[model samples]
Target chain A: MNKSLNIDAQTVSVEANKTVEANNTVQAEKRLPGDLAMWFFILAELTVFAVLFIGFAVSEQLNVEMFVQGKAKLHQISGLINTLTLITSSFFVALALTQMHQGNGKQAAKLLVVAKLVACIYISVKIWEYLSLFEQGIDIETNTFFTLYFMITFFHLMHILLGMVILFFVAIKAAKNEYNASNISGFESGASYWHMVDLLWIILFPLIYVI
Target chain B: MQSTNANKKNTLSWLWLLILTVISTYIGSFLELFNTQKSLFIIIVLFIVFLKGQQIIDIFMELKKAPKLWRRLLFAYVILLPVIIGLIYLL
Candidate 1:
């Protein structure tokens, strides 16, 4: 059985290496078309987010009064600002992808830099918002809604950080002219991930602070 | 696959997203759409984001141009599983 398992592991590694090699060839061939694998990865990510969304929904339904009562104390203005920031950042990333497609690698990298800066600004504002809320004595222990609110938004924030990191890497790669119209999967994938992060914040900002 | 010129058209779409976010925030402050008024804002916000996200997926992600089966599978996996889980939890 152990020998069979070792064979299976070796086979899996071989398959993985073959996939990498094939994908690299596709990249080299400038056949940077979209693929099912990326979508499958995205679908998996969304499923995890959906679970948290469900948690928020169930908690709100279970303790409607407490949730609403807690929501009233939220800082809506800060939330709105953060939402705008994320949306604007997403716009930059999208624009960056377009620039990459136009063969303006330098400009594309600049746009990505802009996107990352905006993301950093958004994070700073969010940290401020979180701290101010804490100062107002609103913490996860406040109630179920606030607890879920903090958890979900903070969770999404981590994703934004990750997106920022990826964008930075893509920006550096673009600087080296590694991505162009013919080889843009990295840029496209990074933009897609950033937009997803922004879209999640779009949902979270209002759900936690505005409503 | 959009060029810079095509991106100009998309800027309007981004503006629309911004406007929607603001409008939803304003609406949430006043309206009660959910079962209770408390989470009405959150529900509305989620709806708006979901709508916008679908648009981005279809357009920016170019999912509409993808193979029909691939699109269907993608949507089913992302949308169906969580909904099923949520409903089961509710039940």
Candidate 2:
């Protein structure tokens, strides 16, 4: 009987170890919130922005007076408004992800719609700011400062547009209950991209408009 | 249950972000009006940008729960650029 008991104890220890290993696997899988591909894209996009920002800084150093004057001509209040709008949109996107995780796909879709609407407002404000600048004869080729400003902001605007397209598809899928807690990679990927847009704006707003 | 907890945490993070943005705007305006301590104000603004970027990465992007390498990459992106910008301005 003692021999049988020893064998049983060994079997239980092995089973326990197996269980622990399985749990670790699950935890490891859970650590990455979204698609690996999206993270790669984010890294690449950030690198481009970093390069552009460095170039802007170098150009600013060369023509501090022009940069300062160009900056003064910018509508600071409008930039501030756009900053707030993007932040609000990002907040909604986060909420949409949360709702998706909770298996509330319809709510998630609605939240994404709100995010898109706010993004539209941002685009509108940006256009208005650009138009006002044009009225003041501040086109892209006017100076180095204007060139950099137009390039960076317009490039960022293109990202926002692309993000909107991604959000459109994600929202449609989410509305159809395509994403749930167990399967939300697409939703997370789209949200991640949108947040990158906001993150870049958060940095850009200060770098160009305020500082 | 987990979703609810995550939602609360995200909402709190968003609130913190909004507050920081408001404070930064106020500081920006103040710097514009006063025009003294320009370097200090710029540093403060960049620091706020860094903090906001960190919050977005950690909370919204959910990188806080990610692997060490992923988190480090993002943290480096957020911190390094601003530090470089600050150094450029200061020097």
Candidate 3:
């Protein structure tokens, strides 16, 4: 009888240790989650956007009146909607990453699906906004604002499309239970990219639409 | 990851981002109202943008606990861009 109790106690202790170790593994200690190469890529991308952003600001400075007039024609409502949409998508992706870290791969996959759905809203709104501008005969060559507007926003749209594709593959892998607490680097890399897309649009909304 | 705490913080960050975005949009909507204090208004909007950018960097990007170098690089971008724009607009 004593032997059986001793065996059960040892089993319980070993199980507790495993749980603690699993939890600790999920909690990173002052480290980056994604690939170092992805960080370099992000820096490079930010540099390009920086130059484009600076150019737009300087051009607006050259002729504030023209820029303001150009801004008036852009759809503010659509801009606001897109900003909210991307931010929401990013939020979902963040949660999904957290879930993945906790070994909840299926739940994380579901969150990414939700993130992709929100991304689709952004795509739909953006395409509609573009078509509306076209309807109003406001192509890039129409003026300096339109030029920068089309160039900057279209560039951003392309990134969003790419991000969606990445998220799609990530979601599929996640649903397959491919990533777990210890092996989430690839998933983290994809999520970081999506957040970057969201980050760019946060700045772009005010730069292009409101400010 | 202490998921419950992490989730709570993320939800809070999302709420803050939502509030800040709406506030900036509302402020920018009042063209005539802000016409007189255009420079001041631009400054305020940039400040709000800074807040939103910080939230994105630290919360959504999950860079707060990252190495100081990486966090500072991204934060610098957020700071410099708005400052440059605000300076141009003010000028």
Highest-scoring model, TM-score: 2
Question: lDDT order of candidates, best first?
Answer: 2, 3, 1
| B37-82 per-residue lDDT for model 1 (tens digits) | 5444444555666566665655555555555665565456435543
Question: What TM-score would chain B of candidate 3 score versus the native chain B?
Answer: 0.94
Q: Clash pairs of candidate 2? A: none
Give the docking tier of candidate 3. Answer: medium
Q: Which scores better on DockQ, 2 or 3?
A: 3
Global lDDT of each candidate: 0.72, 0.91, 0.89
Which residue runs of candidate 3 sit more than 4 Å off their true CA positions? A1-28
For lDDT, candidate 2 versus 3, the one ahead is 2
TM-score of every model? 0.77, 0.91, 0.89
User: What DockQ does each prediction reach against the true complex?
Assistant: 0.29, 0.65, 0.69
After superposition on all C-alphas, the RMSD of every candidate to the true structure, in Å, is 11.1, 2.6, 7.3
Candidate 2 per-residue lDDT, tens place, A174-209, comes to 999988777999999999999999999998988888
Per-residue lDDT of B16-89 in model 3, one digit per residue for the tens?
A: 99999999999898755758887877888889888998998898888998877899999998899999988877
lDDT of 1 at A110: 94
**What TM-score did chain B of candidate 2 earn?**
0.92
Q: Clashes in model 1: which pairs?
A: none
Worst 10 residues of 2 chain B by lDDT: B29-38
Q: Interface RMSD (Å), each candidate?
A: 4.6, 1.6, 0.9
- In the range A76-128, model 3's lDDT, one tens digit per residue, is 99999999999899999999998998888899999999999998999999999
